[model samples]
Target: MSAFIPLSVPNFGEKEAARAAEAITSGWVSTSGARVGEFEQALADYVGMPRAVASNAGSSALHLAAMACGIRPGQEVIVPTLTFIAAVSPLTRYVGAEPVFIGCDDSWCIDPDAVEDFCANHCTLKEDGLYNNKTGAKVAALEVVHVFGNMADMPRLLDIARKYRLTLIEDATEALGTKYVSGPLSGKFAGTMGDVGCYSFNGNKIITTGAGGMLVSNHPDWAEHAKHLSTQAKSDMLQFFHDEVGYNYRMTNVQACLGLAQLERLEDFIATKIARYNQYKDALDGYHGLRILPFKTEAEGVRANHWFYSLYLGETDLDRDTVIAALQEQDIQTRPVWALIHEQADYPRNEAYHLEKAQDLRAHIVNLPCSTNLSEADCARVIDAVKALV
Candidate 1:
């Protein structure tokens, strides 16, 4: 009997165990331990950001980022249709802003051209800021998600932001070590490129802290205020006084300890991800009409974390769901891309701009298993199973 391969799983060893045990024994297992601050500092340094605020989840970090950006009610934030709902939900649910969904380009990231088209064609630049003429709402910010670890077109997006005088927030939950290979932003990490960026450390991420997140920024005030907002807006050190509405979103010390251990091996995990993706690419070559999606390198020097390897099944006989079923029959786990956010029932009234590419992508992309600890033998089995089905 063959072992079932999972879609994604955490990679942990003695270091994780040791750090977590230390935090648990120290009686600082909740949110007040020293490990949390250390982990936050280490992440900020790694991403080249001046400050980082740890939170309970990526969604909470995003809400804090939105609050820091002053996303007010009746404002609009441009987001992509092909990302996790968590990436855009906080903008609307927490801050009372509306989401203006955009399409994705070849990188499976926000299409800068689409963004420009929407802003230039449908918006008016008033003295206050850019406003959507149709909805009569101020276009306050652009929430860009680094989908599946691929870098968005930051240069173009930055130019658009500058022109419109909009805030830029990065939902870099899946792109922790990804950086630009070549460009002005070369050597800069994904989360650091935006005005404010958020990351996730869920169990399935390249690094795991069980469940955690971090909000980062180059601006001192944004970072400081975001931290204040996350810890229930405590106004004083000795008292439980809160001056404003705040969230109990701080990360636990135990989670931070685990994160520290995972962070130590992030580079190695990224290497393994790249190697496994390459192996899958080679194995699937000319095997079927199937195509293993490549990391975005449209720009001269863009390096991706190669997080989740996906297959485009347009040329294959099987559709996305069929392929997933076939893989399951072989005891290999596979899943389709997230349903387009605009098409989701919750966002029925949300405006979507030219979602053709996103719709097409959602129907054809199948995420494959690429966990860091996935063994060569298990990978081979997965490939063989898929080859047989195709």
Candidate 2:
């Protein structure tokens, strides 16, 4: 039997092991180690950001962004229903803001049209900021996630944000290497285009720090504040004095070392991912009802990392569960896209706008094996198994 193929996994080798060993030997394995800053700087340079703040998790980085943005309690953020819950939870649970969920476009990203409609029809621009008429809360921010490494409609989203005084918070946790290849925002990475951006180095992400995240901003103040808040808000070096409420959310030096090593191979990792995605697309073409969702390139003018290749099973006679079961029997792992955030238990009462596309996408998208190290042989085996099952 062949080894089980996972939906997504980290690619680590001797370099990562060596970095870990060095950190262990140096005894600065905690948050205050040199590698932490080195990794942070490396990421900032890679993304074309002025400053970056390292955190324990992507969720924590988002929380820090909200706090640094001065998102007041009872305020609201425009969000997408199609993304992972972490993208929405940080604002609602940690920052005391409300969510107003929007639908996704064909790109499986937050719809710019829906965002405009919501702003024009449902929200009123006031002296202070845009206010949601239904909830009567200031719509302070627009949180856009680059779903499956595909860039969102940033140009239009930026227009709405600027016109309404909404701060753009990019949930770029899944799009580290993704960037616009054309248009006004050409050469800009996913995280750098917004006022603040957050990234994750989780085990299943394109890269891994074991478990770490980073917050970056064009505004130096916001980035600096996020860094200050991440480390327990320590006001003095010698004392445990905290001037404000903060969390112990800083990433460890050990994790940063892993991140440094991983960053070195990011371009190569993206190359492999792209090749694998193309392989899947080429093999599955016209295979009947098994549509491989595209990573928008020419249409969106972006070069995607192709983090996860979505195979929509909606048109097929096979439902997601049946496909999953069949794939599992062959040791090929597959799963449905994330549940719409609005449908989750905690967000029942929050508003979910015309979510037709998101609803369809969530029910049908079967994330295929997209590990960085996945080879042609692995993909062929997966395709064979899927074809055999079908």
Candidate 3:
């Protein structure tokens, strides 16, 4: 029997361990420590944001961003249904904001046209540049996710947000190293383009903080406010002060130590992933009934981190499940894209719009092994197995 080719995992070298050891030895194992502050600064600089706040998890970061953006009960925020539920779940639960689920375009990001149409029909304008919806609650924000490291149509999305006066909160968890190439926002990283951006350091992400996340913004006050709220809204530093209800969402010093180490090798990690992606493209080229999913580089002049490589099974004689089963039979781990969030039992009652592309992709898309540690032999084995199945 051969080794089981796992789908995705973190790549931690000697530096990661050393930094973690230093954090432990320093006795600053909690959230308030030098490692946490340094990690936040390094991430802020890397993403071109003025400030960053580290959090215990990516979902907490999203929740903090939603709160800072003033997402209130019964308000609407546009979100793509084809994303990890963590991106939208926070808004729904923490803020009591209702998500108007949108569809993904070719980039697997939210379609701007759908957003504009939804706003035009459902929302009205306020004097302060906020969009109020038909239900009398303001459309608090627009959550744009950079799906699978692909940049969304930022120009159109930004224009729509501006015209509608919607706050743009970017869920950039999967696009940590992706950068736009053209336009006014050109040369900007994914998370920096929006009003506020959040990142994840989950095990399968491009970088790992052993379960941590960061919230960033060009606006210093927004980042500070998020930090304040994340750290339990304490007013006075001298006393155990409590002003407003807050959360214990801060990231530990130990996690930040790991994050700092991972950040140092981000560029190298991106290069490796891109190389493997190109190899997959070459190997899969001209194979029948399979289309290599496209990244967002061409449209936005952006370079993706290639967090995970997907294949769109186009009119295949074999169903998606069959193809996945075939790959698994060969000890290759391949899985389907995320189930559409609107279809989930928890969000059964949410409003969903123009979800054709998302629905189609969900049924046909397959994600193969894309871990940074995957060797050339592993890549070839996956390619061979996919070819044999097709």
List residue ranges in candidate 3 displaced over 4 A: 126-134, 298-300
Better of 1 and 3 by lDDT: 1
lDDT of 3: 0.87
| lDDT tens readout by residue for model 1, 1-390 | 578899999999999999999998899999999999999999998988876999999989999999998999989999999999889889776789999999999889999999999999999999999999899999999988999998888999989989989899989999999998777887889988778999999989989898999999868899999999998999987978899988899999999999999999999999999989989999885567888888976365787888999888877777788889888988899999998888776787988987888888899988999999998889889888888877
Order of models, best lDDT first:
2, 1, 3
* 181-230: candidate 2 lDDT, tens digit per residue: 88888999998888999999999999999798999998899988899899
* Model 3 clash number: 1
Cα deviation in Å at residue 96, candidate 2?
A: 1.2
TM-score of each: 0.98, 0.98, 0.96
TM-score of 3: 0.96
> In model 1, which regions exceed 4 Å deviation?
none
Model 2 residue 5 distance off true place after TM-score fit, in angstroms: 1.2
After TM-score superposition, the amount by which residue 198's alpha carbon in candidate 1 deviates from its true location, in angstroms, is 0.5
Ranking 1 against 3 by TM-score, winner: 1
**Cα RMSD to the true fold for all candidates:** 1.2, 1.0, 1.6
lDDT of each: 0.90, 0.91, 0.87
Model 2 regions lying over 4 Å from their true place: 298-300
What TM-score does prediction 2 earn? Answer: 0.98
